[model samples]
Target: MESKIKHLEMVENIIERMAKNCFTLKGWGITLIAGIFALSAKSTEQKYVLVAYIPILVFWFLDSYYLQIERKYKILYKNISAKSESEIDFDMDTNNIIITESVAKKLCYFRCLFSVTEWLFYCPTLVAITILIRILNVF
Candidate 1:
C-alpha cells in the first residue's frame, strides 16, 4: 500500500513538471507569433495590409502579458512541490492543489493563443468584405 502511494505521488510530480514545460513552450510560441506579425507589418507597403496587422499587435501584447503570469505560477508550483518531497506518506492533497493550479495557468495561456488565432483568421475576411463593398460602389 505504501509503495502504491509513492508511485502515485511520483506520477503527480511528473505531471506537474510536464504542465510547466508545456506552458514554457506556449510562451515561446507567443513570442514567435509576435515577431512574425511585427516583421510582416514592417515589410508590407499596402495600407489595408498594414491596417490588418493592428489586431495582431494586440495579440502580441496579450501573449507577452500572460507569459509573465504563467512563469510566476510555475515557480510557485516548483517551490511547493519541492517542499512536499520529503513527506514519508505522501501528501496527495497539497500536490493535487498545486498541480491543478499549474494546469489552470497553462490552460489560460492556451486560451489566449486561441483568441489570437480567431482574431487573425477573421481579419483577412473583414478586409475582403471591405474591398468588395468598395468595388460594388464603383458599379
Candidate 2:
C-alpha cells in the first residue's frame, strides 16, 4: 500500500519534470522568435526570417518530443494509480507497455508537432511570421 503510493509519487514527479521541460522549450522558442524580430526590425536583410524559422522549427520539434514523453508518463501514472491494491507492484517501467510496430511508427514526433496543444502555441507565431514577410515585401 505504502509502496504503491511511493511508486505513484515517483511517476508523478517524472511527469512534472517533463512537463516543465516542455514549457521551458516553449518559452525559449518564443524568446528566440522575439529576438529574431528585434534583429530583423533593425536591419534591411530579409534573410532573418530564414534565420528565425530554423530555430523555431527545431524548438517546436523538441517541445513536441517532451510533450509526447510527458503524455506517455501520464498514461503510465494512470495505469499505476488505477491498479487495485492486490494488483499493485513497484514496477514503474513504462517501456514494458506493448506498442504495435505500426502504432509506434505512426506516433512520430512530426505528428505531435501538429497536435492541437502544439498548434495553440505555434500557429500564432506562424501567422506573425507571414505578416512580417508581407511587411518586408512592402518596404
Cα displacement (angstroms), candidate 2, residue 77, comes to 1.0
**What lDDT tens digits, residue by residue, belong to model 1 across residues 12-44?**
565566556545644554455445445545664
Q: List CA RMSD, all candidates.
A: 11.0, 3.0
Q: Each prediction's TM-score against the native? A: 0.31, 0.81
User: For residue 90, what is the lDDT in candidate 1?
Assistant: 41
**What lDDT does the true structure give each of the candidates?**
0.49, 0.78
Using TM-score as the measure, the top candidate is: 2
lDDT of 2 by residue, 1-139 (tens): 8878888899889989988998888888889888887887788885776577777778888888887777677767777777877877777676864455765554566767788878888888777777887887734
After best superposition, candidate 2 residue 56: deviation in angstroms? 1.5
